[model samples]
Target: MTKNTTINYREKIEHSHVYDVAKITPLEFQPNLSARINNRVLLKREDMQPVFSFKLRGAYNKMASLPTDTLKRGVIAASAGNHAQGVAMSAQKLGCRAVIVMPTTTPLIKINAVKARGAEVILFGDSYSDAYVKALELEKSEQLTFVHPYDDPDVIAGQGTIALEILNAHPEPIEAIFCCVGGGGLLAGIAAYVKAVRPEIKIIGVEAKDAEAMTESLKQGKRVMLDQVGLFADGAAVKQVGEHTFALSQQYVDEMIVVDNDAICAAIKDVFEDTRSILEPAGALATAGLKEYAKRNNLSGKTLVGIASGANMNFDRLRFIAERAEVGEKREAVLAVTIPEKPGAFKTFCRLLGDRNITEFNYRYSDPKEAHIFVGVAIADPNESANLVADLIAQGLPALDLTDNEVAKLHLRHLVGGHAPQAENEVVFRFEFPEKPGALMKFLDTMGHDWNISLFHYRNHGADFGRVLVGMQVPPNEQTEFAEFLQNLGYPHWDETHNPAYKLFLG
Candidate 1:
C-alpha cells in the first residue's frame, strides 16, 4: 500500500503474537570483531535459528497472526532456498501446511530440508521468479493462502522484531546498524523499528553488486527489474525489491552500499576467522558493508552492529570461495614469467623467487629457436608483487603479472601448456595412477636421472591418470636417453613438444 501504511502495519506486528519469535533469537555481542573494528559489534545470530536464517521470524510471525480459518486453508510460497526452509519450518511449528514451490536448480540439501519439515516441495522453474510464477498458479488451483516473502505488511513487521531484540539486549546507544538487503524486507522492518525508537541510529542497507535490486530501485525512485542476477549469493539474488519494502527503505534507510563478489568473499573469510562460522556470500553482506564504510570514512570508535544473516551455503561452492578469498583480500597474485629455456635457467629463476612461496608453477617450451618458457607463480601479498616484478627484471627475466586480471584467472590458468614446439624426439607420457602413496617417486625411479624434464605440467584432475606432460632437455647428443626412459616407464606415451599448436601457446 503506502509508505505510512506499512509503518501502521509494523505497529500492528508489535501487538501480534511475536513473543514466541523473540524468545528464540537474542542479540549476542562479538567482542573479538568489535575490538578489531574499534567499535562494539553485536551479532544477531539468525543463522542459528531453526531454519538457519532470520526469515523464520517474519514467516512465523505472519502465519501465527493470520486468522485460524485462513491457516487451515494452507499456505504457499516460492523460494529456491532459505525462504522455502523458513516458510516450511514456520508452518510446521504453527501446525499449518506449507506448499513450497522451488526452482529445479535448487540444491538437494535445501529441497530435502523443506520436505523434511512436512512441506510439499514442488520443483518447478529455473529461478526464484519462475518458481513465483508457478506458486501463483498453485494458489489459484488449490485455493491456498499466499505468503509474500518481503512485500507483505506482516512479514515486514515480523522482521522488525529483530530491532526490538537488539535494542533490548544492548541498551547502550548504537551509532549504526548494518543489515543485508535482499527484497528489502529485513532492512525495511529493522529501519522502521530502530529509527522509530532511537531516530539517531543510522540504518545502512548492504547489497551484493551482482544483485543490487533495492539500491538501484531507490536511486531510480521506482522498482527496476534486473535482467539477470548472479546466483552466487542465492539468498539475496532478487531481481526486484518488494513494493512495501521499497517504500519503507526510501523513508527510513539512511544509506545503501553495494559490494562486489570479491569483497563478499573476503568478508566471508573474515567472519570465519573471527567467529569460526561459515557464512554464505549473502550472509556476509552486512560485514562487507561495515568494512567498506569503515575504510571509506576512516571511521573509528563508533558502535556498529552487523547482522550475520544466514549460513546456508552450498558445500560444493566452498572451493570457489577459497579460490576467490585471496584475491578478495589482496593477498594473492598471479604472474606470467618468460625465462630463457637453457640448462640451469629454471634453477636461476627459482633462486630469484626469494622466500616467496610458489602456490602454482607451470612451464613449457614453446619454440626451439627462441628457447623461452612461460611460467605462472602465485605470490603472497599485492605490495610484494610489484617488488617481485622488479626482481625478475633485475635478474634479466621478463614477467607479466595478471593477478588482477579476471580473464587470466578463469580461462588462462587452465589453458596453459597446449602450445609448444613439437620436438620429433620429445616424448609425451601419461602416468596412470592415483595421486597418492609415492606415485611420483615410482615414475621418477623409472628415469633414474638419465633424462632431464624440459617441459612438465601436472594438474590433479581427480581421475585415475595423473597426466604429466614432460619434455626432457635432450641435447642433440642425448636424444636416445628419453626414448629408453619412456620404454622403461611402461605408460602410454606420445611426443607432442614439437607440435605447432604447442609452439604458439607455450612460446
Candidate 2:
C-alpha cells in the first residue's frame, strides 16, 4: 500500500521483458503552453509511441513476459480501440496470435488497425464490458492467454517507464504530474515510480465525470459498476478500475479530478492549439485537469507535466467535436424563439438578431395564417444569450431559451429548415415520414396542392421516421376545411396551433 512498496514493483516492471521491447523517448517541454500557464508545462508525448498511445508499452510488456507455452497458446484482449491495436501489434511482433474483441460501435479505423496487426478482430456488443465478456469467452474456447489492457502488473509497470523517462528528460523539481485515469493502470504505474523517487512531487489523476469509475470506486471503498458510460471519450470509458491498480492509486495518487465532457472538449482544443495535435478526449483529460488545478489554486510558476496519452481520434467524430467545442468553451448558445410568421416578420427578426453572428438558424411554419415560427439561434457568448433572449422578449417576440436543452442540442439543431411561402387559401399540415427515398416526393404528390403549399420543412433523419414541420396558408379561415383535408391525407396530424408547448417551441 505504501509508495515505496509500489516503486519496488515498478522497478521490476522496468526490468520486465515488455519494457525492454519498446524504445524509450524524452518528455519534451512545451514552451508555448508553459508561457500561457505561467509555468513550465512539459508534455510526456506517449501519443508519439508506436500505435499512437501509451497502451502499446503495457501491451508489448505483457506479451513479451508471457511464458513460452503461453505464447504458443496466443492472447486475447478487449478494448474500445487503443488497447486492441496495442495488443494486436505487440502479439504479432512477438510471433503470437492475438484475438481482439471490440464494441460493434467502435470506429472502422480501429478495427482495421487491429486486423492490420495480424490479430483476429471480432466485433460484438455495445460497450467495453460487453466486448470483454465475448473476449473472455474466446479465451476459454481458444485456450489463449488474456492480455489485459491495464489490470495486470506488467502492464502497469510498462506504463510506469513513462515516469522514468519524464524525470530523466527534465531535471527540474516537479511540482505535479497530471495523468488521465480510466482503470488506473497509467496512473498507478506513473504515481508509484514518481512518488517513490520524489515524494514531494504531487500526482493527480483525471477522469471524465461521466465515466469516473476509479473516482467512484475510491469513494465507495469498493469497485462500483457504472450503468452507463459516455463514449465521447472512448479511450477512457472503463466501468471499473483493476484491483491492483486501484490499490496503487490509493497509495500514491495525491488527488482525483473529475472533468465534464465540455471541459474535455475545451482541453482537446487547447492541446491542439498548443501542440498542433488532435488528442482524443481521454488524452486531453490530463491537460483539462491542469487547467482546473491552475484556476482553482491560482498557482503560477510551478513546473508540471501533462500526459498526452493518445491521438487515435476517429475522423468522422471531428464534426461532433467541432460542434461541441463552441459550447464547451462557452463561445456559443442555442436558443428557441417564437416569431410572427407574416411578411417582414423574419426580416424584422433578422434585424433584431443584430450583430450577434448566427452560428445556426432553423425555422418552420405550422399555421396557414403563418402566425408563428420556431427558431434556434447561436450566440457569441453565454452571457450574451440571456440579453438576446430578453431583447427578443422586449420586441414582443415569445421565446423560450433552450441553450442548455439536451434534446435540442442532440436532435433538433441540425433538423431545422429553411423558410418557404404559403398561399392565402392553402391548408397547413405537419407530417412525419420515414427518412427514405421518395418519401418527401410521395407526400407532396399525395397532397396534390389543390391547396397551394404555404410552408414546408422536411428533413431526412437517419432513422426510420422523419419529422417534418409544415405550414399552408389556407384561404383566410378554413380551419375546419383544412382538418378535413388532413384527415383525408391519412398521415398522423397534430393541431399544434394552440398547444403551449407548441407556442413556446413554435409560436
Candidate 3:
C-alpha cells in the first residue's frame, strides 16, 4: 500500500515449482475458437489443477515461506470459497492447522470441499467483508498467522509462477494475455512477471462489468470500495481490490476490460464446446474478455491467451447459464410484432419467415383488428437479427427488436396477461439499476415513497445491473412533472405503457 518498491518477482517465478501442490497445466490451443476469431486462441488450463483452481500456488507458496514457529501456531484466513480451499489444502500439505472463516452465503459444496482438506471451517456472516472481520478477531485471539489472500509479497510471487509456465509452454509471441481481476492477485502477479520478461506483450485485466473495483481504482489512482458486487462469479466478487495488488496492477498492466454476465455465460458455453469442460462464471471471465478484445482490436492471425481460472461450478446453476447464453451470444433474438387478428393472418405471416427457426411465441388478442405478439427466433449468426427486423418491416408487419431491451428480456418476456382494467392513471416502466444491496431503496427514495406501485417484477441473474419492471400510479395532471423526475432519476428506464407488448400482456 505504501509506495510500491520494485520487486524481482520474475526471478521468484523462475524458481517456483508450484508442482509442490499445483500442476504444470497444459496450454492448449482452442481450434474452434481460433478458427472463429481468426486468431490463435490459446487456453491456459489452470482449471485442471488438483484443487480445480490456481489458488493453491499462492496459498502453498505463502504458507511454505512461513517460519517453523508460525506453522506450529497455525494460520487463519477469510474466503468465500476457492481461496479457502487453497489455504486448507496448503496447510494440510505442510502439516499445519488451518482455520478458514467463510461467509454464510458460500455454497455448501465449496464449504465441504474446504473441510475435506482438513481445515476448521467457520461460517460467519453474509459476505466476505463480514467474515474477514471474524477472521481478524480469531487471528488475534489464537495468536495465529493470517494469510492475506492477495496482499502479501510471497503470495503474489507464488501466483507469478503462472506467467513463467505460460511463456514456457507458448513459444510463439502473444498479442496479449487476458486475466480476470477480483482482488487482483492473479492479474497483479501475472502482469508483474509477464511485464518483466515480455515487456512488449500486453497484460490486460478483465473485470465483471459491475464488480470493477480494480478498474475504478486504476482510473482514480486509489482504491475504491464498491457498495456491492455481483455474486454470479462468486470467486471473483471482491468489493475492492487488495492494496498491494492494485499498486502492482497499476504499475504493470497495459489495460483493463469489463464484461457482462451474459457474455460470461456465453463464454462458459464456448469453453464447454471447445474442451468439454464447464467453467464457473469467474473462470470464464478471461475468455469473455479475449473475445471482446479480439473483436475490438480487429487483430487476426495473432496469438492470445485466456486463463480458465477455476471450475468450481455448482450443478444447479447450469440451467440459468444455458438460458442466458443465447442472449449473451446474440444467437437468439426476441421481438415484439404487430399482426392482424384474423383467420389466415397468422398463416400469411408465417410464410414470410422463409424457414428461420422460432424459439418461443406468446400472443394474446389486444384489439379487434390487430394483435400484438412477443416472439423469439433463432438466428444463424450474431448480426442476423437486424436483417430479420428489416425483413419483417418490409412485409408490412410492424416489428421491434426486443433482444437488448431490459424490460422485455427480464419481465415482459415471461409475463402474459390482459389489461389491468381497474388500474387508474398507470404508467409502466422498465428500469436498470446497479445490482448492489441498497439499489432498490435508492430508486424508491428518488421516486418518492408516496406513489403506489401497481406492478413490479424482478429476477436476479447474478449480474451487475438489476432489471425491474414497475407500474406507478400517477395522475394525468402530473405527466410533465413525472417526465422531469424521470429525466433526473439517472437510471436507464423505458416507458412501456405504450408498448404493444405491454398492451397485450399486463397493460
Candidate closest to the true structure, highest TM-score: 3
Best by lDDT: 3
lDDT of 2 by residue, 371-399 (tens): 43434455655778788888889998866
Which ten contiguous residues of candidate 3 have the minimum total lDDT?
458-467
Q: For residues 154-238, what per-residue lDDT tens digits would candidate 1 score against the true structure?
A: 8888888888788888878888899999998899889988887888999999999878999899999999998656555768888
* Candidate 2 lDDT (Cα, 0 to 1): 0.74
Give the clashing residue pairs of candidate 3, or none. Answer: none
lDDT of residue 112 for candidate 3: 94
State the C-alpha lDDT per candidate. Answer: 0.75, 0.74, 0.85
Q: Residue 402 in candidate 3 has what lDDT?
A: 83
Candidate 3 stretches with Cα past 4 Å from truth are 366-369, 418-421, 424-505
Two-way lDDT contest, 1 vs 3, winner: 3
lDDT of 3 by residue, 1-507 (tens): 345566667787776646678988999999988898899999999999888999889888889888999999999999977788899999999899999998765667788999999999998875688899999999999999999888877788888888888999886799999998899989988998888888899999999987999999999999999866766787788888987898888889999999988889889998998999999999999999999999899999999999999998888778679877888877898888778888987987778766888888887675798878888888877678889888889988988888876567668877754557778888998777655567788777777635688898887654445568889998988887788778767766778888756665676
What TM-score does candidate 3 get on C-alpha atoms? 0.86
